[model samples]
Structures are given as C-alpha cells and as structure tokens.
Target: MFEQEYESFWKAQVRNASGQRLEMLQRDLTGTKKLLEAVLLPVLGSLDDLILEYEMLSVSGMKIYAVVCLPRLRTVFEEDSFVTHAEKITRDRFSFERVRARSVAILGYTYFPYSRDELEKKASFCQRNLFELIGRVGNVEGTGMNQLPVYEREVLRFAVYNRKPFQLKDVCEWLQLRKEACRQVVRELEFKGLVNAVGGSATRCHKFMISEKAVALLHRS
Candidate 1:
C-alpha cells in the first residue's frame, strides 16, 4: 500500500480595537463551534488516530487543531470517501460554499471576528500568522510530495508559483538541464498525472502546466 500525507492549516483571524477584544471574540465561539459542528466533526472524528486542540491566537483569536492518523496517511486528493463525506458536511452546512473536505494529519482552523470586507483584505497576513503559529505542517522530505522526486517537485513548485503554463525551454533554463533531460522529467510528471501539456499544436507540443490535483496537493505545503 502507498503512503501519502495531507497537511494544511486553515486560519480565521480577528482584528479590531485595542480593548476587551477577548470577551467580544469569545462570544463568537458559539457560532464558530456551530460551524465546526457543521464543519469538522463527522469526517475528522471518524478516523481513530486523531487529536484536536485549541490555542489562544490572540486576545481575540483562537486556533483549533485536529490531527488524525500520524494519525492516518492516504493518497493525496484521491481519498474519495473522506472527500465525499467531508465535502457534503461543508456543502450541506454552508450551501455551495468554498469549504470542502479540508482534511489533514495536522488540520487547523482559526476563529476570527472579522466581517467579509475586512476578511478579504487580510487573508494573506492571516494565513501567514497561522503558518508561523503552527510551523510548516507538510514535511516535504518526509512525504516525497505525492511521491514525486526532487526534480519533479521543484518543477511542479515552479509551475505552481509561476501560475501559468510554460514551454519546455522555460523549465530547461530554470532547472538548468539540457533540453532532453528536461523533457524526460516533464514526461514523467505528466505520466504520473501531475502535469499537463497545453498551448501547442498536435505535432509541435512544447508547453507544460501543473494539474489541479497537484495544485491542491501542494497548495498547503
């Protein structure tokens, strides 16, 4: 059996005035747990290897962590039972909401007291703080990035960060490999269904793009 680890921490942050923030924010917990009851339990609790903890993120913010299977490891993005069951909880609870099947060996979500407008403005800062608080959960060396080799992972990382499809010449120069070796690695990635070819004629194909599956698999990392 293949072993794969899923790791992603989700954070909800709170930002407001300087006084009595904790009392105000703690009140939000009731709703938060309502969301978690709607969001976390059924899927996470099912796994026998699981740990759930709460952290004080601020006078106003609290962080929740859930660990399952160390707890449990399964193929990245293809665990349909977990995906289907967990996503249904989110969907039924929130109705076409973006929350879906957010499972991880070290799963964490934060509670923030922010309105939609304020939240949109500070998404990155909030996520950065959560990563800092939890440290990086995905162990790249330990997991092998969905079983990719070093070269493939680097190329995939490049594609993800670049956010676009690129030609073979791009990876060749970036990875500093000869054209032939670059093509080989890209082909292997494509064979694993992790990369795709786009923006080329039938006989003159040359561009490579990262797959959505790989995007979800590595986005947390």
Candidate 2:
C-alpha cells in the first residue's frame, strides 16, 4: 500500500512544464508532491528500501557522485567526508569522479526493517549503484559540445524572464539538451552571473531564479 502510494506520488510529482515560470513551477512541484503523498505512499507500502545518490556525469563521461540520506539521515555526510571503499565501487561502477562535495538529497526513504544496519546497507547500495541506476532509469548524459546552440543566451533569457527557481533539468528541457549538456551551460552561466544553482547537486533540481544582472547587461548591450 505504501509502495503504491509512493509510486503514485513520484509520478504525480513529475509535473512537466515549459516556458520557465516560477509560480507555475512552484505550483507544479506542490501539486506533484501532493500527488506523491496521496497516491504513492498508499500504493507502494514502503518508499524506504533504497537510498538516493546523485552523480553528475559530465559531457566527457566524467562522473561526480553524492550519497543522500533522506528524512533524518540528512546530516550523515555533513560531519563526515562520507567516503568509503564503496566510493571506489562508485567510481569503478559509474566511471566518474565521486564528488561527495556537491551531493544533494532527492527523495529518499527506508524499508520496513528500518534498522541502522539496514539503512547503512541501503546507503552503501546507493554509493555503488547510483550511476548504474540512473542509466537504467533513462536519464541520459550528453557532452557540452552537444548542448543546444545559443544555450548560454537561452539560459540568461530564461533566468531574466522567469525570475523564479528552476532545476537543471528544467533548463535542459527548455533547451532540449541532456542534463550533462545543461550543466555545462549552467556552469558558464554561473561564471557569468547569468544564473545560479541554489543548492548542491543533490538538490540540483531545486533552483531559484537570478537574472536581474544578466537582464541589465543585456539592456546595456
């Protein structure tokens, strides 16, 4: 029942939108979350079997991984560097750098036997299988060179016009590039102060809009 609910919640939360508006996005996320709780939890019976880790596999196929301990496990990595032999597994399995520094927590929960040992094992599972899972889940990575033409300009435009929070995936969908390509553009935009990512890669999806500076520069130009 909980598993089913979680699945419903997950699906409901994936509110796809375009044109990059903040209020609309907020509402979208809110709706998505509500949908998750209402539909997903009751259906899934448990959302607590796996840990979520985010990896930034660059356009060059270089990966940066971060483990996320959800709910109360938030601070697991705060005091600790959160590196382990599993870190090696992450690197080897994913073929990318394990960038624990920028990891962010997406959604995470533990299974019924929610013991510390179970949770740690789940964490270890994420530390190892995150990259692989991402691949299995249809999240593709592309190179900077493959990014949409005029992407930096588009990012600047989106930021200036939207004046709200956004995720890297939002930019990717807006620009029609993969997350890796989107990150490349976002890096350039950040350097130029055209846009910024509020949290680390774990919450890479959580973005606040910042385009006033870029808008001013565009007017000047």
Whose TM-score is greatest here? Answer: 1
For candidate 2, what is the total of clashing residue pairs? 32
lDDT of 1 at 160: 58
Clashes of each: 3, 32
For candidate 2, lDDT tens digit of each residue in 1-221? 54465455344433432232222333323323332233222222234421223233444444432232223222222112123334344646443322333232222322111123323345433322321221122111221211324677666555544545778877887899888888887877777766655765764436745544543333221
Pick out the ten consecutive residues of candidate 2 with the lowest summed lDDT.
Answer: 137-146
Q: Which candidate is the best by lDDT?
A: 1
Candidate 1 yields a Cα-based lDDT of 0.44
Give model 2's TM-score versus the native structure.
0.30
User: In lDDT terms, how accurate is model 2?
Assistant: 0.41
Q: CA lDDT of 168 in candidate 2? A: 81
What residue runs in model 2 are displaced by over 4 Å at the alpha carbon? Answer: 1-149, 200-205
lDDT of each: 0.44, 0.41
